[model samples]
Target: MECAGYIDGAFVKGEGARFDVLDPSDESVVAQVTGVSAAQADAAIGAARRAFDSGAWSGLTMKARAAAMTRFGEAMRKRADWLSACAVKEAGCPVSSTVMGAQVHAPLRMTDEIVDLFLRLPEQEANPLPMHERVNPHFAVQSLKRWSPLGVVSAISAYNVPFYTAFWKVVPALMAGDTVILRPNPLTPLSSMIFAEAAVEAGLPPGVMNVIVEPGLAGGLAMTTDPRVDMVSFTGSCAVGASVAAQAAPTLKRLVLELGGKSAQIYLPDAVGRAASAALSVCTSHAGQGCVLGTRVFVPQERKAEVLEGMAALLATVRIGPAGDPATQLGPVISAAQRDRCAHFTRAAVEAGGRVVCGGKRPEGLDQGFYWEPTVLDLPDNSNPAAQEEIFGPVVGVIGYRDLDHAVEMANDSRFGLSGWVHGADRVKALEVGLKIRSGAVNVNGAVMSSYASGGGIKMSGLGRERGIDGLREFQMVTTLTIGG
Candidate 1:
């Protein structure tokens, strides 16, 4: 199939270069995508601007907008199967772990919640202040604060989980009365195309939402640097995120960035016994491509050997194959480039006195696809590159700490603080240790990312929050109105 960029409410073929969307499982051409030129990107941004300024979408009542979003989501749900297949083929996400979870279900669920939350919000609230007799002695004066859309938003998504990430940014921006220009990563543009189709089917205003597919960063850069775009919600690497921030700085664009992480999973003294099983989660969850996965593991010095042994045994048993196999527990990485990157990190770590406990090379008999063995490295200290960097592959480095304080120190020593994990027998102790870790979200025991709260990062992990009430508010600007009669 040939995919075209959706611009100004039309599925327009790009005047720029064309590229093939490869199926990571076998390197087959799943689809050929035609990319938009700079002019096409400008048109997308212009459309969003016109849509926002015209109030074709933003002028609607809150309830009416919510209804529109609900319809959009329903349109998406109807194509769940196709979307899932496209994601598995293009991104190499496992149907068992990712396609069923984040790919198809979770995003739809988040859309419903965002619409509900948007409708529940108060459009305006009364503000109380003490009367200033010197300034204006009007006792009958009334002050009101209102939250409105920030205007045109450019929502850029990452390839790992493209659809959900884009949906996370787009739905809230729309609910807040903003028109949007969505740019999906070049590697995974299928879902984004479907999103555009759904918007049209849902009867969104002509320029309310737009999608642009490009082989390079030109189109995305246009969306970021363009003055018409009021906000940019980005999800990708830290380096690219920094660039996005810099590009958008001239316009002072509102940004919500979800970037990279070298997060830690700490096993308290008592929890060491349960650590190995839960640690295997990194290997199974889409080959640890997730930014929030705890690739750095901190365990008590006394129990480090036992944890590594159990982890190595479990790693030996993981079934590595293509994403389509129901029996396959571990799928290939997104591409050969990603697999090579993983190998490079593993080799570098080994050169730096790190011992490979189980896997450090490509798996056997799966030479065609980009598959890496579920690797576990026993590191001498937290200073190793494997322990410090974001590999974005199925690799974990285990480091031993002297005590709880030592664990906390090692975990917080990194430059990226996106997320963390804490496990212990004592709930109070686990919660306390979790609170001490300098990350945005911490999972106590087996807790996972929930829909009810906000999640983002601190330090180099990037700025702002995503999901929850705080995320919905990110798309809005506040105004205070003072009236006197």
Candidate 2:
């Protein structure tokens, strides 16, 4: 079926060209998704602005707004099956990974399990600050602080975790009472289209939420640079994110960017084989297309052989095949280009004196799809490009550290600092080492990116937070008022 863009209140045939959405498992054509012209993206931005300005949505009472959000959550839950199918086929997310990851923490399916959490989220701070005491009897002064919605938000979601990332941007901003224009990554946009269905079913104001799937250079540029946009929330690569921030800077629009990560996992001298197993399992999850996947592993130099053996064993057990299969734990990367990326980085690292411990070649039988075997490389130094850069593939590079101090230093010695993981025998020791590293979320012995707290990074990993109170605040503007008699 031909899938068109959802703008304002209905699905429309875009004036721009159309592109084929492919199934990564075998490079088969799943469906056709049409693109919207730059003018169409601007129209979306205009709709959001008009809705916010008209008070059609922003002026709603908190109770009414919350009720709509709850209905949206319920509607999304009803369409969870379609979400699961799209997640596996088009995006190559592991079916089991969507079906309650047995190896990882929490179900990342973005289904009923997660929507309920969004529905039950605590109310935003309506009046965060109290008014000061009266100054005098006749001349009394009152001060009030109010959190108001940002006029309009432009949300650009990433391809890797399109539904999950896009949901975070949409739901919180909607709950904060801001109108949104969501431009889903052209490569993996079906899920967001489904999300728009939920919004419509929940009876959101016609222009309150809009979704567009178009080439990034045109649609994304138009959305980010338009003057009607009050804020831009983006999730993608650092290079693209930098450009988005620069364009929005001139307009002084608020931005929440969740960019790339070369996050590391430090397994101390007392590191258990379980940690190595966890690292291997994660690299295979979503075909290692995750931004927070610990692609770089740091272990005490003495335990390299042990960790390598454990990783090889764990990876051997992973079933890399069609994402449609429920038993399949590892699926193909998103596209042939992504598959090539995995091969190029691994080949480049191997030529630079890195040792390929296991699984670096493309699968011989599975030549139809973008399938490369899980790769584990042993880096001679911490500065190897593969160890320092974000590969966004199923390739794990292992770097050895001298000691605790050395481990911390090496973990923090990257241009990126989105997330980190440290596994040690002593709880206090692990916490200390985890604390020393530069990251938004640090896990002691697991790789869990939870929605319970704020998540984002320092330095180049992108600015602002996305999943907690900070996330809600990102969509709001604060104002103070004083009255005197």
Each model's backbone clash number = 0, 0
Predicted model with the maximum lDDT: 1
Provide the lDDT at 268 for model 2: 73
What overall lDDT goes with each candidate model? 0.87, 0.79
lDDT of 2 at 450: 57
- What tens-digit string does per-residue lDDT give for candidate 1 at 1-485? 45457777887888888899888888888888678888898999998899899988898998898888889888888988998897789888887774358876888777788888878888798886765721365546678899988899999999898888898888888889999899988888888877788889888988888988888988888888989889999999999999999999999999999999998999988888887875578988888889999899999988899999999988888989888888888898888899999999999999999999998899889878889999999998999999888999999999999999999999999999999999999999999999999998888887555456889999989899998888889999999988776
Query: How much does candidate 1 score in TM-score?
Result: 0.97
Error of 2 at 73 (Å): 1.2
**Cα error of candidate 2 at position 248, Å:** 0.8
Clash pairs, model 2 backbone: none
Local lDDT at 21 for model 1 = 89
Q: Write the per-residue lDDT of candidate 2 for residues 59-145, one digit (tens) a residue.
A: 986667878877887787676677777787778777777422321122233333334444465443333334346565557676666
